[model samples]
Structure formats: C-alpha cells, structure tokens
Target: MAYRTWQCENCGFLYEEEFGLPLEGISPGTRWEDIPDDFVCPTCGFAKSQFSMIEI
Candidate 1:
C-alpha cells in the first residue's frame, strides 16, 4: 500500500507514515487510521481530527 502523509492544520506538523514517530511511540509504517483517536499534535496540541491528508 502507498503510504500517505498527514499534516496538522493548526501547526503544519507533518506525520509521515513511512517514518512513524518513534519518539511518540508510533512505529514506522503506522497508518494514520491506526493512530489513536485521542492522539494530539505534538507541536500544537491539536486533535487528530485537525489533520488533513497531504501530498508530500
């Protein structure tokens, strides 16, 4: 499956599925759909819902 990148609408934080946030406890290749619903943006504290699918 093609990996996708998501960006936080609030802070421009990019979440690349190809390089999951290891510091955030997210393993590499972790899909956006697999992230917890309550996960917040590390940069802005925005809710996951605030992210939008973006092309890299």
Candidate 2:
C-alpha cells in the first residue's frame, strides 16, 4: 500500500508513514494525523502541527 508523506514547515523534516521512525518508536503504516500532538520533529523539535501532508 502507498503511504503518505509529511514535511515540517520550520525545519523541512520529512515524515513518511510507510517507513515509521523505529528510533522514535513510531511503527510503520502509522498515519501522519495519528501521531500525537506532543510529538516533535526529531531534527528540529518542531511541533506536530507544523507538518504538512505531501502528495508523494
């Protein structure tokens, strides 16, 4: 199945649903919206709301 991608607005961090961040404890196939609000960008500490969904 195809996965959705999200990009951080402040630091340009890319979050792909198909390949969840194992280091961060987020499992694969987890949707962008399913992530907790308190989850920050691993790269720049940006808030979850700062992430925008991408087509590809």
**Highest TM-score scorer:** 1
Off by over 4 Å in 2: none
Model 2 clash pairs? none
**What C-alpha lDDT do the candidate models reach, one value each?**
0.97, 0.90
TM-score of each: 0.97, 0.89
Model 1 per-residue lDDT tens digits across residues 1-56:
99999999998999999999999999999999999999999999999999999988
Query: Candidate 2, residues 1-56: lDDT per residue as tens digits?
Result: 57989999998889999998989999988988788889999999989988898776
Candidate maximizing lDDT: 1
Q: CA shift at 25, candidate 2, in angstroms?
A: 0.3
